[model samples]
Target: MLGYIARRLGAGIVLALLVTFITFALLSTSFHDVALTILGPAATPDVTADLIASRGWDRPLLVQYGDWLIHALQGDFGESVYTSLPVAASVLQRLVVTLSIIVPALLLTVVISTFLGVWSASRGGIVDRIAQGISLIGYVVPGLLLAIGLVVVLAVQLKWLPATGYTPFTEDPAAWARSITIPVIVLTIGGVANLAAQVRGRMIDELRRDYVRTLRTRGVSTGAIVIRHALRNAGGPALTVLSLEFIQMLGGALIIENVFALPGYGSFAFNASLQGDIPVIMGIAAFGVLLVTVVNLLTDLANGWLNPKARVH
Candidate 1:
């Protein structure tokens, strides 16, 4: 297990480095006139050239990347070209806000999907069909539309919760919950569809496996047979989908954050990209890539633990 974990961790770190390097190289090469973009077009050509030279924008891309990467390793991501704030500071602060909302949403997605999937799979026919139908709707609807509809009907019409904005949980717990509820709901809609459907299908497959039938013939109760014998192996593929959904929700968060006006990594990335703030853009991209890679590694570890057959392969 230790070796397995070490291997996963090593692979994740290597992948994260590669992602950051590739992102930095791509941004550097693809975009031109960074100094002018941030400095404004009205600036004179000499001023622009001076600004670019002063900022080392004229340096070879590799040297720039190397300096940035070294500084990043030492916990300095440099100052934001737009905000002039340390990139790491801004990213981390907003990252906390994002986690407060999205983390709960991810857990909720897992729990809700797991329950619905297991129940629906255990009982085929009407229950399965109903679960499938709901999953279909969730899978089909775009997150932006779902967020809008939820805001309109639930918050605007019913007034059950505040329609938009966020408050820190430390400031007021109730307000925090109220603030994140809509965003969480929006992310969960898609997450449930992604996770539950995969789990249900996987469960059905496991239930039909020869071992499951043998367990039943040994006089095990139906629930025990399904939960104890089938679910362990069945959960592996479901977990894969669940992890992917986590990453998907994070990506979709760009839309949801803007809609709700929550200050999060998504909004930061959006604004930074729009303003040509390369530092913040690079920071956001690296953070996201690392986050997804770590989660994928953890998912693999979980799958191996849940189904030991995974470890052998």
Candidate 2:
């Protein structure tokens, strides 16, 4: 187990390095005028040159990357070029806000999708047909459009929940849930539908296997066979989907957040990139690599646990 974990960590580190490198490369190539953004259009050539030199932007790309990486390793991401705030503090605060919504939405998605999937698979005919139809519709609709439509109906027309803004769960749990309810529902609808389809397929396949028939011949109940035997076997893939969707929600929350006026990492990244805030952008990129690596490792661990025969190594 220790060896397997070590290997996973090693691979994660390598992947994270590659992602950070790519992010740095893209930012360097695309936004080469950090000095101009900092000094403004009215600044003379000498002024921009001096500013760039002072900021070490005039150094070789590799040298600059080395300096940044060294500082980042020591938890020094530097101050944001745009806002002058510490990059880590700014990013971490927004990340918390993003999680306040995404974490609940993820749990809801898994529970809802799992139950629906198992039901549709166990009870065919109308149940399966309806589930499939709903899945298709949800999968086909764009997230932003769905969010807007939901907001217009649920918030604007009915006033069931707030249309925008996030309240802290620590401060007021009920209000927090209410504030995030609409966005969570919007974020989860497609994931739940898609995962339900996958789970349904897996469950159906497991139900038809010879062991399921043997269990039936031994007088095992349908519920026992489905829940105890089939569900476990079918769960590995569903778990994978859930993990992937969670990551997507984490990264994709930007659009929903912007529409809803939630302060989050997505919005931070958006503004940072737009303003060529190298420190914040680099910080976000590094944080992204870490987040992806950790989530993926968790997924692998889950998959391995679900399938005893599937060793982590």
Candidate 3:
């Protein structure tokens, strides 16, 4: 198990390096324009040239990447072109806001989806049909539309929560929860729908397997067989679905952040991309790759734990 975990971590590190290298290579090509954007239209050509040289944008791509990688490893991602703020600092600050929504929403999604999925699969009648209907409704409703509807009914009309703006949790935990409630709900709906369906399908399949019959014949209680054996087997696919949903939520945060006027990495990254803020963009890209690598590694570990056969390969 230790060796398996080590191998998975090593693979994730290699993947992160590959992704960062490719991202750097792609972003470097248009870096000259970034220099121009920083200088603005009033700057002379000589100024732009000097800016490029000073920033090492005039260097060979490999040299630039090497320099960036060295600084990045030291936690110095350079300064934002427009803000002059350290890229890592800015990103990390916003990351907190983003995760506050994503983490809680993900937890709720997993718990609620697991219950509904398992119950539906086990009960199999009106419960199954109702669960399926709920899943379909969640899957089909676009998040933006749902958010708008919620805001109108709950915020505007009802005056229960703020329609926009974020409060730091440290300052006011209750207000913070109220501010993010709508956003979390919008994000969780899709995940619950998708993951619940996957879990239901997998659980149903696992329950019908011959091992389940063998367990029954061995005099194991129905609940024990379902919970201890079938659920464990079904969990592998559910965890895979969950990891993918997490990645989707990260992307989904961009729109949600903008809509709700929250200070988060998604909105920051989006703005940086539009302005071609290379340092900020690179920092976000590296962070994203690192996050994905970590998530995949954890997923592999969980799968290995749930099914020992997974560790063999």
> Per-residue lDDT of 123-171 in model 2, one digit per residue for the tens?
9999988878877766889889998998999999999988888888788
The global C-alpha lDDT for each of the candidates, from Candidate 1 onward, is 0.84, 0.86, 0.91
The order by descending lDDT is: 3, 2, 1
Root mean square deviation (Cα) for candidate 1: 1.7
Misplaced by over 4 Å in model 2 are 30-32
Tens digits of per-residue lDDT for model 1 on 1-313?
7787787778888887888888888777634567778667798988877877877777988899899889988989989876689999899888888888778888988888888888899898999888888878786898889889999998999999888899998999999999999998888878888888888888888888898888888888998987786888888888888888778778777888889999998998988877778888888977888788888988888998898889844
Question: Which candidate number has the best lDDT?
Answer: 3
The alpha-carbon deviation from the true structure for residue 23 of candidate 2, after best TM-score superposition, in angstroms, is 1.6
Write out the backbone clash pairs for model 2.
Answer: none
Q: With candidate 3 superimposed using the best TM-score fit, by how many Å does residue 205's alpha carbon deviate from the native?
A: 0.8
Measured on C-alpha atoms, candidate 2 has an lDDT of 0.86
CA error at residue 255 for candidate 1, angstroms: 0.6
1 against 3, candidate with superior lDDT: 3
Query: 187-228, model 3: which lDDT tens digit per residue?
Result: 888889999999899999988899999999999999998889
